[model samples]
Target: MLEVCVESVAGIGAAVAGGADRIELCAALAVGGLTPPLSLIRQAASAPIATHLLARPRDGNFRYGAGDAALVAQDITTAAEAGLAGVVIGASDASGRLDADMLAGWVAHARAAGQARGRPLSLTLHRAFDLCPDLFEALETAVHLGFDRILTSGGQPRAADALDTLAALVARADGRIIILPGSGIDTSNVAAILRTGAQEVHASCRSPLGEASEAEQRFGFQNGAALQTDPAKVSALKAMVRRA
Candidate 1:
């Protein structure tokens, strides 16, 4: 399935309309994604589809303290309570390695929340996986912890640029985990990424232009509010994935 990473409210509508198999709802895409507010998650999940939440507390780096980790675990419950389909979480040590122990707790928290709420609790190891001190070792750790997926660019800026490394990751994943290629994914490069043998791909799939609404115009007077819903690009990405 092709998953679109949604950065705004309008992006959510566009993804569903364009037939996105799933969505990763987040905020502050400019600094990577951060946890969206509970109200935002509620509005998005109310769409009656598989909308996942990325429980990132901030941008910048992934190294987190115990307090930060606890916040992440709490967010899993918060998102699941709001009816989100899953969550994307990543934690690392001071030296940039996957903190599997902490992730295990977060995963457990998500599963429990999902069960209590009657929702699915899938977990996507965020790009921090690419920063692990040892890629192969981190891959093993993720699988051992039963992570649902790992979102990576295969150790480069773009998935298409790191096809060779991603292939190795797919192999090393050993069917115990899913390798999801992201970062710089677009219609032009999605087919090629799928050819790399990864089952799923990620993309922001944005349009320079977007649709505006009346309410937005009223409150956005003189603001020149830009539309974040890029329906055309979402459809284009879906078409490209189908052909693949």
Candidate 2:
């Protein structure tokens, strides 16, 4: 099952229409990813979605401070209220090691908070796993703490860059958890990524970010710089995944 996790409303629609199994909603993916708007969550749920929330406030590093963690926890609550399926996120130390205690606490908090109403909970430890000191150790921690999946690029710039590592992670996972290989996965190389043994793939498929419409342009929210995303690329990736 290739889960095409996207970050925008347009991407969400495109994926659902294109037959994606899941979606991870976020904002400002230019900075990796951040919590998306509440309205977006509502919009997604209204469309028969299996929406996973991204609990990141900023990018650049996996580690965050106390305040930041609290913000992430709050975002989890928001997502839960919005009827989302789960959250895709991470929290690590400055050395890129899983801060076991912090992660444990976060895991507990998120588990309790997100499923307060008894809905099924899904938690994916995001690409921060790629930055961990040891992939095997990190996998153990996620499994011990009951995460549903671990998303990574095999600790490299892209899947191709770390095919061996991705394979190692998948083998280490060994059915106890899911190793979802993501990052730089597109139509040209999705089959190769699948060959690395990832059960699911992640991608933000949509066109370059541009203004919503003339109305938004008139209101001054339009910007010239288009964000990088394209539905065609997403569908292509899906095709490769299916073929694989």
Using lDDT, give the best candidate's number: 1
Cα RMSD of all models vs. native, in order, equals 3.9, 3.2
Candidate 2 displacement at residue 149 in angstroms? 0.6
TM-score of each: 0.90, 0.88
Alpha-carbon shift of residue 56 in model 1 (angstroms)? 0.8
Show model 2 residue runs off by greater than 4 Å: 209-225
Candidate 2 residue-wise lDDT, 84-163, digit = tens: 88888788887788877777877887778766868866889988888887888989999998899998888886877888
What is candidate 1's lDDT per residue for 1-244, written digit by digit as tens?
7888887778888888888889999987767789988778888978756888899887788888888888898888888777777889998887788887888888788878988987668888999988876788889888888788999999887889998888899988868899999999987788778887898888888765544567777786423435364778888888888877
Model 2, C-alpha of 179: deviation from truth (Å): 0.3
lDDT of each: 0.84, 0.79
